[model samples]
Target: MITSKLMRPLTTGGVLASTVLFASGCKSMIVFDPKGPIGEQQRDLIYFTMLLCLIILVPVLLIAAWIVWRYRDRKNNRAPYQPVWSHSTKLEIVWWGIPIVIIVVLAVVTARYTYALDPAKPIESDKKPVTIQVTSLDWKWLFQYPEQGIATVNYLAIPERTPIKFELTSDGPMNGFWVPQLGGMIYTMSGMATTMYLQADEPGNYMGTGANFTGRDFAKMGFTAKALPQKDFDRWVADAKASGNALTEEGYQTLAKPGTTDRMTFASIPSGLFERIVHDYSMSRGAPPGYTLRAVTLSEEKKAEHTAHPKNGQLPPGNGAQKDAPDAQSLGQPDHRSGHMHLIHGK
Candidate 1:
């Protein structure tokens, strides 16, 4: 059955598979090559967890192979014959106790990091965070720089070492917002805005994409995240602001339609557009009796709400509001600088 014809095809297939594997292994792994603080911490945790598993895995595998070889049924096996030996208290304790101790250690370390690396937690930097609104569309991603007054489709830009507060929401199904080299994936769901704080420590070109399944054009839902120096970022913003393609209400409506398109930029965007989107999505035509949620949209308006207790005001960005969330002043503000309207929307 092992003829030359069959052998030829098998050899060719093996060579092709090896070549593909070698080529793939040569490619860059963005996660392992983290350029940001969050990404680096996450990568460390991954390596630690993997090594911890290997601590158990390696020894268990080696012992299993040794047991198989040493205890095999052979003509002259030298292994001890303890076939009826199963229950030893010392053995049970060693086997069960080792795994239990490892699990506890893992749980403790994991819990510590889970709290430390929270996506909402602010970075310890002197620079005021730049706020960017992110909207996941039918098959595209939209980014609006509220402070910079510019918007881009399938693209992102930020200054190095400055924290970026991304307010994420979706016009369609829940999509995963991920920039692998910056941090982990944060979800953008319809009817609500989710908060994520990410920063890049180095100037580099990075790729971003929707990490969840959407529809037929899901593969095309990728974007570029470029980290530039402060001066260069400002220059880019100024150039975009000088451009003529302003996105108005009508323009945004057209852009929101379900289709894939090339990179787009707008010199200006309608005010309160992001707040309106969150409000509209949350306020359905027929939401039951009274289902309303306070969204964390404008960090500026939220800032004014916190200056009531000036001590908390000193706290950076989102931290103060969260600490004093139960305070009446923290609920919503009377007006927003972006829209000059009530920050809170009623049913």
Candidate 2:
């Protein structure tokens, strides 16, 4: 009857859009509510890749609702019409062998959780990780704490069940660093140096952010992690090392320039100020003063005088945007294994 009155307003508009997405609650989905052990091993590898994509989406939605209710548009609808019904080799080997065995069991469960969530490895813990550092300025987020020498800025605290190493870099440009309950999102570039590790197993506060977008005070960067409880993170690192506020190196180059402030605290940081902000972006006179660094390349005779000889060299057209320097410099290298995404030059 006109397809049950057009599926009764498309099944009541998909049950009022799933009751307005279940009344929008999920406690701000802190990445499926994780709280540590690397966000519960990345939420159990996102619930085993959504239970292997609902085993190919519940058998292709119950065989597309039993081939639309056994071939509808009926009046004496005796189903099996077949009308030169194309080939089948057992339904094309059961739909291409069940998506190649669900893509080889999702590439062996994403290469065994990308080496078990390797945001720079180290998170075994009977407690002894802590480090910190970070940086990502121009919008903000400093952190430091080199074994509690202390430093803060947008703020982070750490400790609950221990194991946080971090390190990251960037006085600007590259960004990322997230903390959706305590795991993924790493990045933060500028003259390299990255590494993550994380942990948390309870205690609270969370929030952190800056998953990229660098411009207009990229929504004021954000930061606040907290965690606490190793004697409340050693009494909040002894009240941030007795906040006699120091920071130096001219106050971390005026808190790495470009704006946004509040939530500061120091009490000494500036010995190797995050190893000179990762060696001031491989300085040969580059990324330091007001460090912005989005592209970084130069040299190799200015990359063979900005290459692109197209018309005769051909292939130099569309997909541009790659001036280079996006990954590998592992500052003072000790194999900062964010699985090295290539580009390692900087002498």
lDDT at position 216, candidate 2: 92
Best by TM-score: 1
In model 2, what are the clashing residue pairs, if there are any? none
Q: Which ten residues in a row have the lowest lDDT in candidate 2?
A: 324-333
Q: Estimate, for each residue in 165-263, the C-alpha lDDT of model 2 and write its tens digit.
A: 888888879989899888899888987898988888888898989998999988888878988788877877788678787878887787788988889
Q: What is the lDDT of candidate 1?
A: 0.84
Off by over 4 Å in 2: 1-7, 14-16, 19-27, 32-37, 40-48, 51-55, 73-87, 90-96, 103-107, 118-128, 131-180, 183-204, 207-235, 239-347
lDDT scores of the candidates, listed in order:
0.84, 0.77
lDDT of 1 by residue, 205-281 (tens): 99899999988898999999999999999999999998889999998888888899999899999999998888887
TM-score of 2: 0.33
Clashes of each: 0, 0
Residue 125 shift from truth in candidate 2, angstroms: 15
- Candidate 2 residue-wise lDDT at 303: 36
